[model samples]
Target: MSDKAYDDRNNLGGRVRRYARVGGSVGGLAARLAGDRLFGMKIDRDDHAMELAQALGNLKGPVMKVAQILSTIPDALPKEYAQELAQLQAAAPSMGWTFVKRRMRTELGEGWRDRFASFDREASAAASLGQVHKATDTAGHALAVKLQYPDMGAAVEADLNQLDWMLSLFRRYDKSVDTSQIREELAERLREELDYALEARHIALYRHMLADEPTVHVPAVYPDLSAGRLLTMEWLDGTPLMRFTDADQETRNTIARNLFRAWYVPFHRYGVIHGDPHLGNYAARDDLSINLLDFGCVRVFPPRFCGGVIDLYKALRDGDEALAVAAYEAWGFHNLSRELVETLNIWASFLYSPLMEDKPRLINPADNPGQYGAETATKVHKKLKELGPVTPPREFVFMDRAALGLGGVFLRLGATLNWHQLFHDIVGDFSVEALAARQNQALAAAGMEGTVDGR
Candidate 1:
């Protein structure tokens, strides 16, 4: 190992420092609740949120990850905490050269330097879980090397405990939604991301699935050079998604159309969905094509679940209550009382409203620019409160998150299209049995388990 290379941040001393830093801040916030038993001196949730963000920002791994999770699940965090955590998704600190050298040695062994024609010392990009470095192979092919931060598994488990406490606090503020299932889902997906071998196969699966898609691209994984923590893939040169915001309407619309296909084609045609949508996961080429990056958070659902999504859309569009209830059941939602069903429909209506409208329009039709589905979310929250604590089925977590994240993307592009037509173009030939066959073949070929977290 190189000198002081690959710092053992997951070691006892390191973990203690991490926990102490966060616990000290959180402990102060929890003093009243701890002493008085959930209610005494009031905790300023917003202030507590800022302190938590500060604590996470100071640390390397867990806080940003937990923040990313809270950002996805609706009402999982208070607005203040969510916003703070959301920022951390893009602003993770990078590991220094010594750490990088040690990581490369571990992944590629002593002769790692000779394998690359050139490797940049500075990271091209960094996130909570890992950092990417630009490199060139001996044959001159550009590559992106993503190195997982050391001891991420340990840090993740430790921080997930803290996340539990954070969510408990959130539940105190809003008892409408029981978040235990959602937490389990987050933990499952986050742990899955640690397995780069699985992700490499996800890349292969996408390559096979999207072969005919002219507007979408998935990188080629280097299996020989990749380990459980390190992934090497062909570098995609493209502009960031937001860089197109100032582009012409036609260009923006084309980009949005491509994004729509890139995201949904796999879901409708197969039972897979890319679970993360943090904007950084995709980029736009000169012709407005998309480069799909990051396969770590892929979710492969049962074909029935995929069919249920469309069924719910059709039910909402046609106002078929019976179909809607069946679809809910298919999605694994238990005993849906009339009021709860009505509340869920309100939220579903917002998601499906775009496809119902035959005319071209903005995704978020509110008069003022707002968070996509903000009003709908608020209304649903109010209704859920009235209806009492509701357990959200596991499948709903990432599905809902990806939907809102994509809508936010469209709103940013200011794209206008007959969303109804676009949606139909994809869903017109949907078949449950066919998707089941396709999903099974894909899973078998990729050597992946059929269930997402044994669900």
Candidate 2:
């Protein structure tokens, strides 16, 4: 091969090697955590786990992003794993100037100087996979540039392999629980999430889908600056969702309404779901509109599934077991025996409790026994043990995550609203056929031309 060809091969080989190294580290860390927990092995579980999580967090690549996703979505990992991975949320170490410059030069041309009026070397925010920097284009449009770390796909795949091993260890440790569904769910979404180009398009799709919803915001994409690894968009300014406590009741309610639309308008109205529910993904502007960020984990479901969701809500409210069963079956639960069905109802009831009630939504601890969250987890584990493994068809994973993520935000705001009524208003005209038609139209317009049958 020529010298240039040899250099290209060598660079590719280096990337593969680095990915393997990180993958190996992930497996090693899981083993260490397991040994400490299981055998009463003289290991400081907290300190050691924190160290391992920090190491991955420091990497700030695909592995770290996966960890962050697992952290926020409860039951994706066992309790200890979730606890450790949760740290990755705010804990990812930012990339330094050296790496940032290298990445920018590669993404833009070496003379890419003319593209931007100014680009900040320092990152404004850092997370598991990439970092965002505030910049100004030559056209003077203030923008946020999300730059992926080089070779994130390789890192993600390697880490996922390690994560599979880690989940197997978890199953061994807790035989009562089968996490096959969670594993499948995370794996599929993580793959889609690794593509920044897909994410960029997701933003554009949302912009058009939610065009009339003033309370929710989606940033304008700059296609000229985006690629599979990099994204540039209009920078949105807002306070973090966590800061809602400082706002008053009306402000909180307004924020919640926007947040409600931010989360459900796509799924309920357009059949697309923003899968990542981390509190960081949304913000409340001074104008009271909710600004959504991070489109990497979008999950587009069959419109039938959304209709099934609404039907399920109606069933729970009317105490119609048959309707509930139809909805669950529609959502892809197979060979669901009567016992399994009943067991599921216990869990479903908790999830749909807000929608079932005639009163306004109040996520107060006083309202729930805190029993549903933990106890339902235990019950599901027991059922999985006895009734054979259950795989929660791929689509529900992110829907569940988004719901909890939004719930967490609501809990933070301590805002109460008539959730049942709002839900009814959205789905009152509920027809799976209509939803499918609208969704198909939206997807076609966005160049995502395909039909999604519930099956």
Candidate 3:
């Protein structure tokens, strides 16, 4: 390989290029913020936001990860930026065959092509950390080949540095929720996603946890062909979720039910959740069942945290303030005043309303399609503004991200369900110790190091 064949992302030159790309992309927004704050000039957030988003979309890296999570959090970014950033596709166009050849040789040796019956030179799918190519093994079994982008480790750190600056500016403008915890958590998850080895383990864990879930499918990992930066797995087939958005009501409802189970069964039973619920992470099958595609962003919660989620649900249903307080504390929220708790409960009520009702119904019936949680989020923002700063525990960020992301999917499907029964069945048999045991057992079975009792 030539010296310049692969970008030296850890070198000074690479760092300069990345930072320059990022700054050039969003410099206008930074200028707007600076002008609005320093020069006493008015700058609308909506101005050039789409162009800014388009600029970011043209590249793939940390900004996309940060923006994806921020989109799930209400009012984290100005509405225009959030909307535009949400539209940023997670994947960039696939790197060309030259890059692929170099990457394949690095991971699988010079004879890499001979290991497969045939490997597509073009990427079938691309995303922030890596792109996937469809291939077949020597035996002709279908496979998905995931190859990490070069120097992603360095790229992630560089992007996080830039993220720190942007987040600080955001804090300067709006201090409604202290996002330090959220930012740090996102950094950890994004770096973790760069590790295909860890992600392969996550895939194993999910397959084990959802073994009984006939409606959900998990792909099998191929250790022989997988490495720290490359992952090979069974190529599962399904349709992207958007294809089902305009389907018949029955079909949509069935798909929604399957999705809910796919997401929550892991959490309610094993204390693990698929942290990333972007539309690209899932696909629908002919039978209305769904395949969970991406396992790179899984989160394993403490058992006490899982218990607290149940406690909060019961408190909300029974109107028990004492239980609610305990739940909040268990979640690591400190310095909560009565008014603050009440303010938090206002948002909680809206999230839990669907499940509180026994009858089957749309997740957000009164609102128009694609408008799920818009009104409630605005109300929550207003209440939080009035009640003063409420620091969200780090755990809440991903939980809320996955929850809200799934809710958006439900809205897109227009699915109706007896959410109350679904909630009851999951929580009825729940025990803190049992969940801890289940979590530990599942992690151990998958060769993962996790103890639910660990802090």
Report the lDDT of model 3 for residue 152.
Answer: 73
- Candidate 1 local accuracy as lDDT? 0.80
lDDT of 3: 0.82
Per-model C-alpha RMSD: 2.7, 3.8, 1.9
Best by lDDT: 3
Q: Candidate 2: what lDDT?
A: 0.72
Sorted by lDDT, highest first, which candidate order results? 3, 1, 2
As for TM-score, the candidate ahead, 1 or 3, is: 3
The candidate, 2 or 3, that scores higher on lDDT is 3
Report the error of model 2 at residue 7, Å. Answer: 12
| TM-score, cand. 1 vs. native | 0.92
Model 2, position 97: C-alpha lDDT score: 76
- Tens digit of lDDT per residue, candidate 1, span 94-183? 989988888988778999999999999999988778999999999999999999987777666777777788678667767888899888
Worst 10 residues of 3 by lDDT: 1-10
Query: Each model's TM-score?
Result: 0.92, 0.88, 0.95
